[model samples]
Target: MGLGLATGMEFYTFDSVNLVLTDLTGTLGVSADEASWILTVYSCALFLGVPISIWMAGHFGYKRFLLGTVVAFAATSIGCSLAPDLDIMLFWRALQGLAAAGLVMWWRASVYLLMPKPQRSPSLMRISTMLYLSSAAGLLASGYITDHANWRLIFLPNLLYAAGALWLIARHFPNQPKPSAERLVSADWPGIVLLAIALIALQVILNRGEIDDWFGSAHLRILGFVGAGALILFIAWQMSAANRTPLLWLELMRDRNVLSSALLGVLTGMILSGSVFVLPEFLRNVASKTYSATQTGQIMCVYALTAAAIRPLMVGFIARVGQRKAIAFALVMLIMSMLIFNRLLTTGTPGWYFALPLVLYAFCLSPLLPAVGSGTVARIDQNKLLDGVSLYMTFRQFGASLGVALLTILISHRETLHSARLFDHVRHDNDVTRTWLSTVSGTLTTHGGYTPLEAQQASVRMLAEQGAHQAAAYAYADAFAFMAVVGIVALCLLPIVPPTPVQKK
Candidate 1:
């Protein structure tokens, strides 16, 4: 189950890192800022989805749930591949998220059910190891697909994989339907809708904020009100009901570890998701690195190597030193890598430059999350574990959305500011500036056969483009710095409390 699921999930993090948005914006001609909603919408869908999915899984048999999820997931990938417009793309993305969350929740429940306590240790290791390798493979493959083939080709392979998986499960895995009495129809629909509304509205505001110049544009302004209203209503709805199926049961908040993990997952996922979103695009497009299939694979391959190498060692370490300590170290590595990222980021920096720190960060991160997750979910009541994992994963999903949106926003904002600053120095103010501009203009005119005057204006536009690239690079650096601080604060805020001096969990 672990191997099958891990292989299926191998591509989970790629959409985040490979930055399908860059292709969507640059190739598909979507607006630069609007493109981020591709990620934002997917994540927000997952934010409120995992819990509902878990309940349905419990109500239905696990095998049935898994099979159904993959079917939906496969179909949606096909739809996403053929989507013609941004709005249509968003709808497919949401469906994909829904299907994905269901698949993952069922896969995890299956793993826990199949493996005994002792076996779970090594089984978990195998799953983690496979996930790292497959994720690296997917990232590299996606990049190559983007470069050589159409982006849609990437999903073709997924469709084949999912179909095969679904077929095997249907044939081999028999489902034993549970008693209807055990599965009550007690879900809180109002809370669910409000939460979804809140998340969707907020995503719209963030993703479109940069392109619309924050609130200066009316879309963002109205979105702000909608997001705020939804959030307020969501809180009221959750608190007002003395219900059995609160979107997130308030009783679960009694556990500190669960609450901490839920919050931490959001931030940690943000850093991971956002970095993956921006860094690769910056490498390939901005720095002009030649990322042929092998080379692009190698960049992610390095990070995977580090994750593979460190995660196993931390497996034992997590058992011994505990999750809180491991999370702290992971945060330190994140900070160190972000510092390296902040200082070394430049338009001229090569692909190989980010290798060492990237590896370390990957290593620290690979095991840190599973460990923290185990600790957090361990706090939940035994019966409510499905709910616990759902909540944990949900926040992590939202964090990814917010992270991408914020990073995109930061890149947009800083580019404008820096470009404005540099334009002053480059404008046609003096002989040197005018000659420099005209020379660039002359080259364009000669190459494309434009008039001398037309080329001059084109040259100015070209200069502005370069200025924006440089500004974006600087902004990327600053964003990494802020991400590092968030890591540090998260690490320190939650102490690795003694585990009641108990034996291994």
Candidate 2:
């Protein structure tokens, strides 16, 4: 039940942003660009705060920490719902991110603490199933609320989940005695500060760079430099620091299996995050006929269902063929999904056309997520497991943010390029352009009883709209092609990851 609440709340918070962002812009009188910071700030705060939270949880017992964070998370969700301006919302969202980081860390921590090492894989599989279900259901539920009720009610699911989480923790988990003040104060404050600077600055640059014209904007250039320098300093400080409470437990990387799994974690994040970001935007804004939020959500639920169905087979396949081979097969499915999209995406493509690729993508996700996560900490020292998991998740979150930003930039640049090239071919002197314009003008004159001048103007406007649609379609196709190539490269890397050693049941 604790796991259920955690899974539900995670999906609710993340999916809430995508499902209602368009409505949010109108309700708050903010541009879409401004609205994007809601998710960006949440992710940035989570990435920077997770390692610190993991370090501190040892001082403050997991049960207390989990309950406090859940309550705080619920409170911030309410605050976000009530926020009247962008600044207020952003402030609340940052706090929400901090609380969410703690909740997720404690969620995994609880799993590790309560169960024996051998029992963990099965437990993880169950938790992964919950995650997939919540992801499938959360978006549809939020979209329904946004359409029929209020956008604010989109967060109601988090409140429900948090209430249940609080009840379960309070009832079942015992609170340990608090550590001494000295123990709390012993954390490496300098390392924490430097790490925060690096993570937050990098996220800000990625989230806002395209809108600000990339490096052309002085602000982004400054952020890029700060992020780079701070990242270098943070790494140096962690490696050489004599502090007993270092920000990251660098020793976790000594285990080759954990290191390889961490890399796989990053790719898994990129795949899932990029899909969540792109599919909704493409359906909502760029489809030949725009789809309603609820419709898009329902379609995406297909991906979730596919994942859930295939999960039972994944563990057996891993056991039979080994983790390395399992991951390789999943990557092939992923590449197939992306290639299908590359060939099929177009303005004229039907809504149903997305189902096949989405299912294949889901097939990739179901196996790889559990495989990488279990393989990552399978051989780690029990005392260092928390740090290892925290670091793994932090990398995954960073990859998620990076993938979304990169794909957004790619589509925007490609759209502009395609639009310009298309324009050159559709000029007034072109015979095809002359014939199309004449046909459109004649139709307008006959049907709408418009004058020649008005008909010609309307005809030109329609042609321009169609051309823009075609350009966007081409851009999306190119983006899909790029992702397919990335998947293939990821598959090629599988040969280097060592297989999990045999274990007795």
Q: Pick the candidate with the highest lDDT.
A: 2
Writing each residue's lDDT as its tens digit, candidate 2 over 313-432 gives 777677777788778888898889988988888877787989999999988888788777777777777766776788788777777666766677788889999999999999999999
What's the number of clashes in each of the models? Answer: 0, 0
- Candidate 1 TM-score over all chains jointly: 0.87
**RMSDs, each prediction?**
3.5, 2.3
User: Which stretches of model 1 miss by more than 4 angstroms?
Assistant: 10-13, 16-20, 167-185, 211-226, 239-241, 288-297, 427-462, 496-505
Tens-digit lDDT track for model 1 on 3-75? 3642455254454235445666765577766666777777777666677776666567677777777778778
Model 2 lDDT at residue 493: 72
lDDT of 1: 0.69
The residue pairs that clash in candidate 1, if any, are none
**Model 2 residue 399 lDDT?**
70
Overall local distance difference test of candidate 2: 0.78
